[model samples]
Target: MLDFTCGRAIAVARNEKLQPELLKVGELASRAGVTVRALHHYDRIGLLKPSARAASGYRLYDRADVARLHQVQALRRFGLPLAEIGVVLDQPDTRFAGIVAEQITALRRQIAQASALRGQLVQLQRQLQLGAEPDLANWLSTLELMGAYDSYFTKEELQRLPFFQFDSQRDGIWGRLVARIAALMAGGVPAASRQARHLALHWMRRLERDTAANPDFAIRMGALMEGEPSARQRIGITPELKQYVIDALAENRLRIYANYLDADELRRMREHGGKHGKQWMTLIAAVHQQMHAGAAPGDPAVQALTREWFALFRQGAGDNPATLAKMRLAIDSEPALLAGSWINAEMLAFIRQSAATLQAPR
Candidate 1:
C-alpha cells in the first residue's frame, strides 16, 4: 500500500537523511536483478524514472524508487505486460489493494496450473523410474491427441471421456471400425441400406458410451467437430469422411421411414420439417429430457409430449386412416425413422405407447 500512494510525500518530508544513500542506475539494476538497459527503458516509459542526479550527471535512484521498482517487479512476476504495469503505477489514485489483489488472484491460478503440470510430470517420471518403458512415437502421438482435446474439451469433460481417462483398446476398435467402413465404401455399399445404417448405429453407440451418456458432452463434441475441422483432421476423421458417415445415418433413417409410408410421405415430411423445424426441435428435446428424468410412457408429462408430437405428425401427414396407419407402422417398425436423436429402441417404444394411451378411450 505504501508503494502506491502518499508514502513518497512522507518519506521526502521526514527522510532527508536517507538522500545520501541513493544508488546509481547500474548499482540499482544490479541489486534489483534487472538490466541497466531495462532501467533506462523503464525511465523512458515514465514507469520508474530515477529521482536524483549525481555531480557526474548519472541517474541516481533513492529508496522510494526501490520501493516502486519492487512493486513493478512483483507485477512482472505475475505475468502482466509492462504496459499494463505502467498504467497501474501511474494511477496513484487507484486502490493499492485492488491492484495487488488482482495480481494475487492471477498468481494463485497460475500456481495451481503449474502444480497440476508438475503432478503430471512426476507421474510420468515415476513410471519411468519404475522400469515402465515408453515408446517414443506413441508418447508423441499421445501428446498430439492431448493437445487436440485441450482445444475442445474442458478438464471435467476430459475426465469423463474414455479416450482421456480409460485404459482400453477403444482406439484400436475405432481404427478397425473406420477401416471396415472405408472398405465397405470401396466395395460400393450404399449409405442408405440397413447394413450401413447398423454400422452407423454401432459407431454412434460406441461414442455415446465413451462419453458416459452425457448428452451435453456429446453436444459439445459435435460442435467441436463442426467448428474445428483441423481437430477432426488430426484425429483422422476428415470432413469428407465425416459427412459421408453422417449422411449415411440420416439417409438410412429416411429409408427406414419410407419402408412403411411412401417416399412422398418422407419427402413432404422433410419439406414441412424445414418450415416447422424449431417447434419440432423443441418438442423432441422435451421428450428426450423427460425420458432422462425417469418419466415412464404413461407419465402425464410424457403423454403431453406425445400429444404435441402426434399433433405435429398429423399436421404433416394427413389424418387419413390409411396414412395414419402407415405412420404408426413406421413408428412401430424402426426407432431410427423418427427425426430426433437418441430416439432409439426404448425411447421409440415409450413414444408409441404414450401415443397409443393418449389416443385410447379416457
Candidate 2:
C-alpha cells in the first residue's frame, strides 16, 4: 500500500511496448484529410469511435480505427451515405465481401453509362465535322427526344427504323399523303367514301414502307403515337384520324376480296391471312427493299428471301394449285387490291424472277 509509484511506472513501461500507436482527433483528421468536427460527428453517429483515452481524457484513435476511417472515406467517394457506410462497415466479413462485389458492379454500370454518353458526343462531333452547322439548341432538343425514344423503343429497333435511313423521297411521299388526308378530313369526306378508300391504300403503302412491313414495328409505332403526346402532336395523326383510316382500310379490303372468293374461300383466306399476315408483310418488305437497292433476283440474298417467300406462300395457300390460281386471278384482275397491298405488279414480277432464279440449274 505504501510507495507503489515504482511498480506503476514499471507496468506503464511494459504496456507502452505492447500497445499500438494511437492518434488524437486532430492528428487523425489532419492525416486523413477530414475535419475534427467530422470525426466527432462520426463518433456521435456510432460510425467511428476512438478505442482509448489519453491521461488528459482526450479521445485516441488506434490503428484499427484509422483503417476504418479509410474505408469510410473510400465509400464516401463512391457516393455512399454515411448511414449506409456505417451499415456496410458493421456487416460480418462475408457480407462485407458481397458489398465489395456490389460496389464493383455499380462501378461497371457507371463506366457503361459514361461510354454511351461519350458515343453520343462523338456522333455529334462527326456531324459537325461533315460541314453541318452545329445548332446547339437543335442538338439539345434532339438529344432530349432521343432519350424520350429510348423509353418507347429498344436501341436495335430504333436503328432499323426509317428515321436513320435518310430517305427524302419516302418522307416527301409521307408528307404529301398526310396533307391529302388532312384536306379530305377538312372537306368532311366520310371514311366510307371512294376518296377515303383510295387514301387508305396510299396510307397502307406508306405505313408498310415506313415500318419495313414489320408488324411488330408498326404496332410499336402505333403505341408510341398513342402513348406519347409529343409524338402525336408532331405527327398530327390524331386518334380520330387514325381510327378513320383503320375503318376505311378494313371496309376497302373486304370489298376488294369479296369479288374473287366464295364464302368458304373467303373464310379460309381471312383465317390464313390473319395468322400469317405480319410475317408475309415482313418478307414482302424485305424483298421490296432489296429490289429498291438494285439487288439482282439471282443474288444469293434475294434467292434466300425468295425461298422463304415460297415456303410461306405454300403454308398459306396450301397444296391446292386451284386456290393459288384463283387468288392470283383476283390479284391480276383487281387494281384496288394492288393499290391497297404491298403485292403490286412490280413486286409480283420480282418474286417470280427470284423463283425462276432459284429453280434454274446452278
TM-score: which candidate is best? 1
What lDDT tens digits, residue by residue, belong to model 1 across residues 214-298? 5555665766666765546545666666656766766666666677767677787655544554466567667777887888889
Clashing pairs in 2: none
* lDDT per residue (tens digit) for residues 1-362 in model 2: 11222322211122343233666777677768899999999999999998877666667776678778877876897899999998888876625455467667767656755765776677679887998776676556545555667886786676567643444467567768777888888899988788998898789877867776555567567677777666665457888888778667756765777787677766765556545655776787688779878999889999998888777866755656677777778778877666535566877888778889778311
Worst 10 residues of 2 by lDDT: 3-12
Clashing pairs in 1: none
All candidates: CA RMSD (Å): 12.7, 17.0
Q: What is the C-alpha lDDT of each candidate?
A: 0.68, 0.70
Count clashes in each candidate, considering only residues at least 3 apart in sequence or on different chains.
0, 0
lDDT for 261 in candidate 2 is: 65
Q: Give stretches of model 1 more than 4 Å off.
A: 1-160, 183-190, 193-195, 266-286, 291-321, 335-340, 345-362
Q: At residue 13, what lDDT does model 2 achieve?
A: 28
- The stretch of ten residues in a row with the least summed lDDT in candidate 1 is 4-13
